[model samples]
Target: MGASERVVPEGARRRRRPTKGGTVLSEQLIVETTLRLIGEHGAAALTVRRLGAALGCDPSAVYRYFKDTDELLLAVADELIGRTLNSWRPTGDWRADLRALGLRMHADYMAHPQAAMLACARVTGRRHEIRSVDAILGVLRGAGFPDAEAVRIYHVFVDQTLSFAALDASTLALPVRARELEARAWRETYARMPAETHPHIAATSGVLVAEMDRSGYPAALEMVLAAAAGRLAHVRSGPPGA
Candidate 1:
């Protein structure tokens, strides 16, 4: 095989790509570009060839920074987590703080709907994710919930936040016409359902038409916070070991 065609060893740094318009490649640049491409063309646009093309480099160069596409994607997911938590300051009121954090997370994810759809369910296990987990645990523990209950509530809080983000993002990610169709379904189809078969839906159709198109994350977040507050009250009311 020609020396020029030799495969680069894993973890070995490759020479920088010859500059095109003096643009240099870096992990941050690659991630940002990937996000832009995903935003422009959806998640399917995230392949190595497309990324390299966008960055003006060989596809192999991406492997130097990320072990594989999955690793790169995890980094992208971590970036979203980082953006959500960046410069976040807790207000010392657990409920208020959590509500703010949850809202911030949902907003950030919705801003990058295509990326959120791809990443919301991933563990990431990267630095940003680790920090978020620690920060949330601290919030729970700081609220005076016992360790066990805190952990349980943290699981529910994070999962519910991400799940709702992904769910809402899917709607946002749809093509404009498709989204319009979905909105029309809530207003037209459900609102016009037969009183004989879907009596409840019929009776509540007016409310559903008004509400169904809206994202449910805020209400769901409130319910979670309320449940956690109740749990904390119960724990405080119990004996120490109870």
Candidate 2:
């Protein structure tokens, strides 16, 4: 059959895109290319025209695989989440498993700060995201929490991870000079605050100066996990079916 009339096998549909200018394309290729563009040149380089140029095809070819830039971006975000969870094999220890997941999420996103700045808050509804939700819920339920409690804890765990990842990634995305200035603010400004005018900050200024530049994600993740553990215990101790 002629190329235009040829039917892509059902299983191949997800991986294949229509060709243009002798350049073969696929959904995965576009997503990977967009990631490279964002990583190398920052998020500002993510336009369809730029993507098409990188792919050696006309700009419209990108739309053949993704409905629009927003849709394509959601795919990109999902790809990041997928990579973090792809090889992750959860041990039976729920808390430790969750801690590992949270750290991986933060580290991966922070590594791709430009992309994370755009994608961290998105609800991709893609395969990887759905799988992540199911995995977390499984961990909670396996630990003996009821469905309702499991869902709530899942929200807290996932949202806290993503929120902190986004926040930290934003800081990482800053120019080196800007980040350096921010790192110095606590030491040079807050640490110097007058005790009479800013009693609380003045008192904690030493600790703040030492710790303020660090990402708070690890501490925040631990707090969420600890709170979830407490909630699980409370549920276990409640009256039967109460």
Candidate 3:
């Protein structure tokens, strides 16, 4: 019989069909499962073998979807970006909208503290991510920024927000052993500082320690937005000589 005319065995044909809930695995499923695993066990506990086990498949199944761990991390990062964009609504006021988006992004990363570290520097080139960049650039352009200036500000805004979020999450998610060591280091460093040699530091030491719990993310984001707006205004008002 011709290959096209050959009939499959009854049991083999049945096996080829998807079960009610066992549809063909997809990238979304993988990414969602990865995030859930990271949330439950932390990023360090995530491995291809473990992830597959959690997904009821073999490690090779993941490779069919993602090239490697880095690719998977990038997909996770893209998923995070999509989540942030979904939560942010852009009001007509560019600065306020941008600030709101930054705050939301920070909070989202803080919620998924473990994933932040892995995703901080990844650029996934996903569609929604590109649209986000375009939206921010459009906002800046509408606010009278030159294309070049808008692009620069976009980079600054994204990098600063993500970097800050990652740093905050990493510090907060430090393992118990690491946290104790960090505390000891802080005590030793402070003890070694002579009051006269560092009078300003000594005076503010208590305030600094006490204010560590204060939310600096919003303040820092505001500062960046203000600086960018100021620069844009200056560029608009000044001539080539100025």
Candidate 4:
């Protein structure tokens, strides 16, 4: 063959093999890349085009894994929930286990603040998430809660934990520039409020601003556990008059 038309080896004529790192993407890779993008750019900037650009592929590549952005967000949520499950374990002390789960979840979301906000309410019914819900329910039931009560407590506990984490992440994901503006506006608003017109607000202003940095998730979770335990105790104690 001519120099430009070199003879091909028996195996060399085959189409180039896809590299393991090629643009042929998997759902996990898409979710991971999307999460990384969300972490750096926040949810609003995580369009199909942007994600595809980051992944070094065509925008249509994402569609091969997820039908739309909502599907992609659901996948991201499932991935976060799976991460939480991997880090959580029941330590025999139901209340303590619940508290640990809450704290760990908060920490994980804070680690990926923008992604956490984006995936907050998108539930995928993924196996790991279902397993987590079941595990929490089992703990409540083992703590002497009836099936209905266990389900109720589980719903409240999971919802409260996720909701607080999302809210915390949303605040943390705010740009420093936006935060400064918000801080200035808050100070101005607080300063203009008449003490006589809003006695409780005026009285609590200092405490509110001072304690804002303190983590409230632990306290809030403890209160929830206390309420659940109290309700369980009352149910088992027979009537007060008895």
Candidate 5:
């Protein structure tokens, strides 16, 4: 097919002009396909050839939607954000809403850890990324935070959520054997530390052992939300001009 007949049109990636008699692909179609590929085969599975095979188009047609794998990767990442945010409806309680949102993001990342590891902390400057920032800021502002405080709290909440997601995703993205070894160490080593030598470790051994098979995102997320809650409480209690 000719350049003008390709899915993205001749001038820009934003255009969704599908080719004549070719498999009609759009940016959304390509992104959805990319996400599925990553979910099934990990981040290493994405390539123009593979995507073309999956989409029933020429490999060159894949480039009609994206300049390269890196660019397409950003789109995939942004799609995850869009999917998550789109599914979330805000509750009036800010703390509960924030907690739920954080957990959702953590779960979403865990579901596609390789993709999360690649894009969790990335600043995509895409529509979904912008929407995510707006959503969080709206939550804080709606909860009665002043503009500056809302902005600061939004940064803390988002950074904490994405950072923890990235860390967990990195571990999940590791090869199976390596992850098994790490789990073994967590269960065997930390759970078996001697009381005399490490009283705190021994005391917490049960929790540690149980957590060996768990993602620590929930507890860490709770801590972050609790901190924000305290800040909000303190601001509410401040004297009139102080």
Candidate 6:
């Protein structure tokens, strides 16, 4: 090794084992590095060969932990679930709790936009994923929704949040310059549309521009929560199966 070049300390560099190069390789390390690569270089950078190069090991070594890329991707998705659920600090109000948790999930996915693009639709069937489903259903049922209604509402709540998050993250995962340009589209394009050509847009353009900087997910989430709350009230007062 050259003076500036660091040596690859002996740690099964040529073998498929726990540690590699100078680092102790684990599921967490691989997942974290995969996310970092996706964040820094987009999802395309997550190939086994690329990861091996980054970790200073052979590409085939990746199989020691994950059987293949799909499993690794699921693990990455599960990690996102862990982070989102872990951060949630629920308020007593069902509406408020759902809103906060939904926003948290959205923000968490957006934070890793490249990964979100691939993993948002994945059902990990892991601990984090199972617990999250249970918790959401529990919250709704606890708030007076019967089992079937609670399950239906939970599906809507999660699907809406993840679907919108994936859409937003695609834009966010773009190159920084591209993201800036897209971010300004509402103001730079729609807000400037001539009033004579589009009266309704002109009338509300000011408010549109003001709120364009805001994400639509939060508002959409509130609508879902409010609708569920209303249904719960009805269900509570109505006779059984009425």
Against the true structure, whose lDDT is highest? 1
Q: Residue 131, candidate 3: how far off, in angstroms? A: 1.8
Candidate 6 residue lDDT tens string, 151-182: 99999999999899899988787788997887
Candidate 3 positional error at 46, Å: 2.3
Provide the lDDT at 212 for model 1: 83
C-alpha lDDT (0 to 100) for residue 192 of candidate 1: 93
Rank ordering of all candidates by lDDT, starting from the highest: 1, 2, 6, 5, 3, 4
After superposition, candidate 6 runs with Cα above 4 Å error: 1-21
Between candidates 3 and 6, which one is better according to TM-score? 6
Best by TM-score: 1
Q: Candidate 5 lDDT (Cα, whole model)? A: 0.81
Model 1, residue 134: C-alpha shift (Å): 0.2
Reference-based TM-score of each model: 0.90, 0.89, 0.80, 0.80, 0.85, 0.87
Query: Candidate 3 residues 1-242, lDDT tens each?
Result: 12233333424333244323565556778899899899889888889888877777656656656667777878898898889989888888989989988888888888888998888877789866887888888888888887788899999999999889989888878888997787666466654567889887677776665555455777788888999989887987898633
Predicted structure 5, TM vs. truth: 0.85
lDDT of 2 by residue, 128-183 (tens): 99999999999999999899989998998888888888889888888999998998
Instruction: Flag clash pairs in model 6.
Output: none
Q: Write the per-residue lDDT of candidate 4 for residues 98-192, one digit (tens) a residue.
A: 88888888888889988887666667787767888888888888887878888999988988888888888878888889877766655667645
Off by over 4 Å in 1: 1-18, 194-197
Off by over 4 Å in 3: 1-24, 180-194, 239-242
lDDT computed for candidate 6 = 0.82
Q: TM-score for candidate 6, please give it.
A: 0.87
Q: What is the TM-score of candidate 1? A: 0.90
Q: What tens digits encode model 1's per-residue C-alpha lDDT throughout 182-220?
A: 888888889999999999999999888887878888999
